[model samples]
Target: MMFLRYLAAVPLIVLSCAGVPFGYLTLSSYLFQRSLPGEPAEFDFVAGFVGNVTALAGFWPVPVAFLLFAGLWWRTAAWPRISLLPSVPTAFVGLVTGTGWAIALGVALPLVSWGLARLAARIVSRPISGDVRRSAVEVLIGLRGGGRLRVQSRRLLLDRLPPPRYRESPVGRVAIPFDRIGHVEAGVVDAPAQWRFGNTSELTITPGPALRVIGSGQEWLVPVDDVDAALRLVVERAQARAKPEPRPPLESARWASAKKLWDLGEAQLSQTGQRKVRHGGHHVLLVLSVLTVAMTGYSVFRVFTDGWGFLFGALFFGAISYGTGRAWVSAGATQKLAEENPCSPLADDPDPRHRPITGWSYQPVVLGQTSDL
Candidate 1:
C-alpha cells in the first residue's frame, strides 16, 4: 500500500511542476497578446501547438517512467540506492550544456547548474510581510493568557466588554487578568521599586488572602473568590515561567565545608575594603587546578592529531564527564550539609530533645529551598 501511494504521488508531483509554468506562460501571453487582432497566423499556430505540448507533458506518464525505473533499480541492487533519474532542472541543464559534457562532468554538473536551480527556488519562494508575522506572534501569545491580550478587533462585541480590561500590556506583555488583581500599592517615598515591564507603574497583588508575600514591593490587589484559587494561579504562573535555574558551582563534602570557610573570608575582606579574597580550602583548589590542566592538555593533543573529528568526540566525552561530576558533587554537598546541620527546618520545635539527627527522613521538604528560609 505504501509503495503504491509513493508511486501514485510521483505523477501528481511532476504534473504540478509542469502545470504551474504552463499556466503562468498561458496567462501572460493571453494578457499581452489580447490587443493584437491582426497577429501573424504563424504566431497563433505556434501558440496552439505549444499549449497542446504543455498539456500532454503535464500528464502522468513521464513521472511514472522515472518512478518505475527507480523501483526496479532499488529491488535489483545490493548497494545503497542512488537516484539515476535527472530532475527537471538537471534535464534542462543537460539539454543546454549538451549530453557529452554533462556525462563527462557527472554529478559536478549540479554545482555548475546551481544558478538555474536557485532561480527556480526563488520563483517558488515568496516573502511574508512584517505585519503578517507580527499578527501571528500576537495571536499565539494572546491565546496563552499569560501576556496582556491586545484587543485589535474593535467590533461591537469588544466595545460592550467590561472595564478593568484583561489585555496584554503594550510593555512587558505578560498575561495579567484584571479580575485576579487584589489591591494596588504604589511605591514608597524613600525607595521606589523598579518597574520592569515598561515605564508603567508597578503593583504587587496578593494573589489570595492567606498566601504570604515573600518579597514585597508594590503589590497589585487581585480580588479572589477563594484562597485556593489564588494560590493555584500564582503557582501555575510561576511554574510555567520557571526554566531550570543555574546550579551552584561547588560540590563534595570537603568542598562544601570549604565554601563556608570561603564565604567567611569574603565577609572579613569586605569589611576591610578589600575587593577580592580566596576562600575555599587549598586541597580543593589544587584538585580542581590539576584536573583542569590535564583536560586542557588532552584537548590540545586530540585537536592536533585528528582535527575536527577528534574535537567532536572529545566534546561529547567532556559533556558526559562534566554532567556526571556535577551530579556527584551536588549529592555529596547535600549529604554533607545535612550532616553539618542536623536540625530539619520542618522540626516542631527550635531545639530537639534528642541527639542531632543525620540522613534523610521519610517526609519530603516542600515549599521553598533552605535559602528561602
Candidate 2:
C-alpha cells in the first residue's frame, strides 16, 4: 500500500515542477516559429552524455553522504555501531528510482541527519549544573518586602535567570525567599512565550544571580545566587501549605459513560489537524492551477505559428512536471506523519502526540513542553 501511494505521488510531483518551463517553451515556439531539433546531431549526443554522467555522479554520492551522517550519529549514541553496507543498499535503491526519488531522498537525508544529531546530543549532554544553592520562602499576599524573585524549574537549562519576588493577592501556596535567590530581575527575559500562558501582564521578581527551577516536571529559569537556599525555601513553604480537598477519580464506570462524549471532541481535534494539512495542499494546488491556465493560454497562442506542435508537447511535459511536484510534497508530508505515528494492526489506539504541523496544532517547545504562550 505504501509503495503504491509513493508511485502515484512521485509522477504528480515531477510533472508539477517540469510544467512551468515546458509551458514557456511552448509559448515561445508558437510565437516565434522556433524548432526544438534544429541543432546538430552532435548536440543531442553531448546532452545525453552529460545527463548520464550527472545521474551517475548524483547516485554515487547518496550512499557516501548517508554513511557519513550515520557514522556521525553512531558516535554520539550510547552504543555506537557502523552499518555502511546496509545503508549503501538503500542508497542504490534510491538511485534506481530516478531523479524524483533521488531528489526526495536528498531532501529527506538532511532532516534525518538533524534528527539523529539531536537524539545524540540529548544522550551525550550532561545535566544542568547543580553547584549553586539558595533558599525559597513563602511570603504574605500583597506584601511589600518581597523584591522581584525568579521562578525556576530544575529540568530546563536554557536562558534560565532568576526573577524578582512579588506579592500576588491571595498569594499562591508556596514561594521562595528573596535571600535564597542567587539573581533576580524585574521582567521575563528570553523565556519561551508559552511559559507566560498567554498572560499579557508582566510580573516582576530579585537577589540578582542566575537560577533554574522546575515546575510540574518542566524546567524554568529565574535569577538566583544560590540554588540550595532557593530549593530549601521552596521545600519549606510547600511543606507548610494547606492541602486541597480530594476529588473523585474519573476512572469509574459512571465517569466512563460520560467520557464517550469527550471522545467526539478528540475526534474533532484530529479532524481539524487533518484539515490544516489539506488546506496547505489546497493552496499549492490553487497556485498550480493558475499557472497551468496561463501556460495553456500561451500554448494556444503558439499554435498559430510553425513550431506549434513542439510548443504543445513542451506544455504537456510542463503540466506533468508541475503535478509531480505537488504530489511529491503531499506524499512527503504523509510519509513524515506515518513515520512519526506508526500503525499497529492489533490495537485501535491513536497516538495523542501525532500532531499535524499546521494551524493551532503548531506549538513551540519550552522546557520540553509545548505551550501556547
Candidate 3:
C-alpha cells in the first residue's frame, strides 16, 4: 500500500529545456494576447524583437536559446505555460513567428515535438521534450521513488530530496559537482511496473535498467527509461568536467573489457606454458579429419577412373577434410588426454594458438623460455 502511494506520488518537476523554444514562444504569444507589461500608446516593438530574438521570458529569448541549444542552460521552474505545452505552441503562433506562419508552425512544431518527446520519454521513462542530445532531462532517483535528478552541464541537482529514514532530517536540494563524478555505470532493478506517459501506457518494464552515478564521495541510482543513452550522457559529461581526454563510448568499452579478458587468458597461458581453454569436440574433429582425408584421396583416384559423380564425392570429402583439420588443430586437445578426458582444459593440443598465445606453433619460439611447452 505504501509502495503504491509512493509510486502514485512520483514527483514531476518541470523539466523544460528542449521545449523551451516552444515554451518561450508560448510566453511571447501570451504577452501579445494579454498585452506586454508597461504597454504605452505606441506598442512595444522593441520588446517584440527582443522577445522573438531571445525567447526566455518577458522578451529575453536570445541568451536562453543559445544556452539551451548548447546544453548549458538548466532551470527548475516552468517559464510560463510550460505545463500546458501542447496548447502553448498553438497559443503563441501569432506573436513568436507572426500571424501568417503562426498556425502552421504551432501545429507542426508540436507534432514534431510529440514524436521526439515520445521517443525520449520512453528512454527516460518520463515525459520530456525537445532533442535530448542537447537538452537536460529529469530522472527519478530511487528505483520506485526518491527525488528528481536534474542533469546539468557542470553539476547534478537532486531536488526535493527525500529523507534517508522516517525520522526527521534536514531536507534540501543536493548539488553534486559534475566534475567530481568519477564512475557513471548502468545497471538494472527488479521493479515490474507499468510506465504511464499520458492516457496511454506502454508496457516495457520487467527488470528495468537504471544508471548508478558515483562521484563527489556520493552515489545516486537514477532509474531512467533509456539507461544506456543516459549512461552515455553521464559518462560524456563526467569526462568533460574531469579531463581533456574522453572516456570510450559503450560499445568500445565492452570490446575493451573483452580484450582485457583475452589478455588475462594469454598471461595465464604464458605463465603455465599451456592452454587451459575448455573447448571440446577437437578429438572428434581430429578423427573425422583423418577419415575424410583418407576417403577424399581414394575418391580423387576413383574420379579419374570412374565418372563425374566421383568428382563431386572427391570435392565434398576434400572440403570436409579441410574444415575438420583446421578445427582439430585449433581445438587444444592432446590425443592421449582427449581419449582419457575429452573435455579437460588441461589437455594440450599441439596447436600453440590455443587458449593463450605463447607459442611454438602460432608465434615463433624465438627464446627458450616458452620452448618447453
Judging by lDDT, tell me the better candidate of 2 and 3.
3
User: Please, what are the lDDT tens digits per residue for candidate 1 over residues 1-373?
Assistant: 3234334434433333333333333433444355457762333645754874565564332343334334332221200111222234444444464444343343343332333323322222112122211121111111111222121111000011111111211111122222222222111112212211111212222222322211111122122234343343333323233232222444534434323322222223221321222212322333343344345557768899868656765675566556555655565444333222222222233221221112211111122321221
Q: Which is the leading candidate under TM-score?
A: 3
TM-score of each: 0.17, 0.19, 0.29
lDDT minimum window of 10 residues, candidate 2:
164-173
Candidate 3, residues 1-373: lDDT per residue as tens digits? 3233223322221223234344445544554465535643443655754555454443222223223223311332222222234334344644465654455555555445445433333343333222332344333333334345556545665554332121111112334455545455565656554332110112233455655554443344555666655655555444444332233342442223122221122223222222222223454565566567777888999978887778888899999999988877544322222112111222232332221111111122211132232
Ranking by TM-score: 3, 2, 1
Ranking by lDDT: 3, 2, 1
Error at 335, model 2, angstroms: 26
| C-alpha lDDT of residue 373 in model 1 | 16
Distance from true location, Cα of 170 in model 3, Å: 3.9
Q: Which run of 10 residues does model 3 get worst, by summed lDDT?
A: 355-364
lDDT of model 3 at residue 98? 61
